[model samples]
Target: MNIHIFQHAPLENDTGAINHWINKGNHKKFYTRLYADDPFPSIDSFDFLIILGGPMGTYEEDKYVWLIKEKEFIRQAVNAGKKILGICLGSQLLADVLGAKVYKNNKKEIGWFPVTLTPDGRDHALFAGIENSINVLHWHSDTFTLPEKSIRLLESEACVNQAFLYETHVLGLQFHFEATPDSVISMLESDSESLSISSDSVQNSEEMLNNLHYSGKSNEILFTLLDRFLAL
Candidate 1:
């Protein structure tokens, strides 16, 4: 498969389960580094598109010019029926492009948190290997409403809409199932200001680091989802 990745930040690239899948076969992988002004590829060039998380909000197009172009790229990909996976800010982008409202949640969710699959999600093949509820990594202040005609998949204590599925081809996740230890550290370092804020919803850098084992189980779920997605 010809897969293309849209990486919004220097530190927030896909790793762990995603890298494992990418290295599994002869499949080609490509990337567009939006932070460094890397050129975007045509929608037809890739069979699968994976958009990574970033610190920026979806509405900050004025500050990040590429967001406008990226949205258009996502729109074109959806129109073309590309298989798409979005994480965190990437998920918010997908929601907004699909005409859903994206905004700040009542509280930010950082570190490890539990996410429960909705009935639709539990029954869906995309989550076949995942448990009904599991702790996954979280690091977002914003949440999105379910897109029109989309199935609400996951929910958390701090965020109601942790995930959504738009048709069979598109999946959006607010939490990071693809994050590695290095990537988590990168986030803590890059967004240290946000981490400094004290709240019940937030976890300290040490706490986030201590729970690396959660990703082991999360990566298993990720691989299950990816296997199903690739088969589609």
Candidate 2:
């Protein structure tokens, strides 16, 4: 399979998601960072497009001029029938481009949170095998509306717009399923302002890293989703 990943920041790189492809060992991977010196690709060469998260807001387009271009590319990809997955900022971008409102939430959720699947998500292909309510890492202040044609998937205490599926292949997940232990550490180390969490709700990097007791089922569900897409 040919896969192109649009990475918004260096710290929020694909972790287990890349590993999912690497374990297959028969796919090609390409990465581009719009904020950095890199440029976007033609978008036709890849069979799948994975848009990773960033700390920047969707409307920060004025500051990050490439936002418009990236959105156009993503829209074209979705219209072209390619499988796509958007994470955090990427999820907001998908909703915005699809004529859905993207804005700030009431409270910024920045740690492990429980996500409950709605009726539609319980029957969706990507969410296949996922349980009723699963805990996933959260680190975003922005939220998005479900596209008119999208299927509502997950919801949480702080963010009602946790995830949505526009079609059989296009996905927008607010929470991080691709985050690994190292990626979590990198994020914690890089974004100090986000760590202003009170002692009661937050755990430091060392604690998070040592806490392998966290559920792996959500990660497994994401893997199944990726495997299904690649098979198509």
Candidate 3:
């Protein structure tokens, strides 16, 4: 399987969480920030499409012209029966492509938080037999509306629309399941100006990377999800 992973920014890489066990499949990365003129390929050429998170908002298609085309590309991919996964901002963009509203949430959730799976999620293969609630790493300020054809999977205390499934082939996650320690530190350091964390809760990049609750168990669940994805 050849998966096409769309990277919106330099900081948000795949972190190799999904492909930890599935080394047989191949992947290709396309950075929209650096190459705004790059055209999207037909959905048939790729087995799966994974969109990584970025610091941009879903509605800022004008400010970031590449977003408009990226959303359309995702829409076409999902409509073509291809497997699709979106993380954080990528999830918001997936909702936008599915005719849902995306906007700022009441609070900026930027640490580890517990998310409970819904009945539909409990029944699905990706989340089958998984615990009712699991702590996941989150770093986003925006949230999306539950799309018309989507099933709400998980809900956190701060964000209700943490995960959703539009179709059997499409999945959107509000948390960072693909985050590695290096990628986490890269996000905190490169985007320091965007964050406003105090010295107590989240002091610096190193502290955020060293946090056990966020990074420790995340890879386990992430690989579990990826294993299900590869099987599908």
lDDT of 2 at 195: 63
Q: How far is candidate 3 from the true structure (C-alpha RMSD, Å)?
A: 2.7
Candidate 3, overall lDDT? Answer: 0.76
lDDT of 3 at 84: 82
lDDT of each: 0.88, 0.78, 0.76
**Tens-digit lDDT track for model 3 on 1-232?**
6677787776666545665544634455433342346667767777877888888898987788888788778888878888888899879988998999999987778765678988888888889878999877788889999999888989988888999987677889998876666666667777776457552322355446567446657788887887686576
Quote each prediction's TM-score. Answer: 0.95, 0.90, 0.87
Of candidate 2, the 10-residue stretch with the lowest lDDT total is 206-215
Whole-model alpha-carbon lDDT for candidate 1: 0.88
TM-score of decoy 3:
0.87
Candidate 2 lDDT tens digits, 56-143 = 8889988888888888888898889888888898899989988999988766777776789888778866667667888777888889
Candidate 3 local Cα displacement, residue 145, angstroms: 0.6
Q: Supply the TM-score for candidate 2.
A: 0.90
Please identify model 1 stretches exceeding 4 Å from their true place.
Answer: none
Point out the worst 10-residue segment of candidate 1 by lDDT. Answer: 10-19
Each prediction's total of clashing residue pairs, residues at least 3 apart in sequence or on different chains, is: 0, 0, 0
